[model samples]
Target: GESVGLHLPTLSVQEGDNSIINCAYSNSASDYFIWYKQESGKGPQFIIDIRSNMDKRQGQRVTVLLNKTVKHLSLQIAATQPGDSAVYFCAENESGGGADGLTFGKGTHLIIQP
Candidate 1:
């Protein structure tokens, strides 16, 4: 069966260092990709997003990379801080701007090591 999900369960990074979180998606039909951050006791918050047409996109301190050939996606965080410690998730939308909700990955727990 096809699967769309994150590749790692957790990632530990030192403060001020860069962090990379990986995800794998199965549905090539997915056109939109979004990365979200979820702190403990809080809902997922949007971080960055990229469309399937592009292979990479950058935000303030973050970058989203997509590899359609292998169906992989990655989020890179520059200068990871303690506040950046949270569960990160990758979501995909295949409905092509339709009303259907996105399908989210399991999520990767990002821990900032002091």
Candidate 2:
């Protein structure tokens, strides 16, 4: 289950164009960061993940960047397709706190335009 602790936001991008989704997390102690993509009526699917020790990580055509200094995170998707349209959100786990300590951010709806 996902947490709806804040207002939902939206981002629209054109098909074949690169899309960048930004997230700002508040837990300075968080050691792990994850990006999730959720289609309507479905569970959140893992996109990519990063750790406090690393500044960036990439998966397939997706990239995740974590800036602990500013407590910021962002996901970049290359050549987005219609299938890429979904609700994307970021989750973080406090240092030493495993999956059980995961905190979700307010999600943003990604819209792909052809």
Candidate 3:
């Protein structure tokens, strides 16, 4: 897949500060967007999601902004904590249905300095 290119695998951030995670997508036909946060070895938890019809969406201390015009998406975490430190991943689902799996980016490792 085109998304599987060589890329850096981690990110470091300080605690109590805002963290911004960026993602670049290639499929123009993709319509659904999702942001997930995984702590250590647990499964990814859904943080927020936005459809192509909207550009921004918010939930609790997290916000997701989608820019379909440029094929980009971002996840913003406010007041990052040591517990909040984890691997964040942004995913996209194409318009068509079926077992087509989610295309996930390399992910950003959020290191919170407590």
Top candidate (TM-score) = 1
Expressed as tens digits, the lDDT of each residue in 1-112 for candidate 1 is 3446988899998999999999998887888899999999999999999998999999999999999999999999999999999999998888655437888889999999
For all candidates in order, the CA lDDT equals 0.91, 0.84, 0.81
All candidates: TM-score: 0.93, 0.89, 0.88
Task: Name the top lDDT candidate.
Answer: 1
How high is the lDDT of residue 93 in model 1? 85
Model 3: residue 43 alpha-carbon error in angstroms: 1.1
When sorted by TM-score, best at the front, the candidate numbers are 1, 2, 3
Model 1 segments beyond 4 Å from truth?
A: 96-99
Residue lDDT tens for model 2, 1-114: 333232338888989999888888766777888989999999999998898999999999999988889788888999999999999988888665445766898888999999
Between 1 and 3, whose TM-score is larger? 1
Please give the lDDT score for candidate 1: 0.91
Model 3: lDDT equals 0.81
Lowest summed lDDT over 10 consecutive residues: which window, candidate 3? 1-10
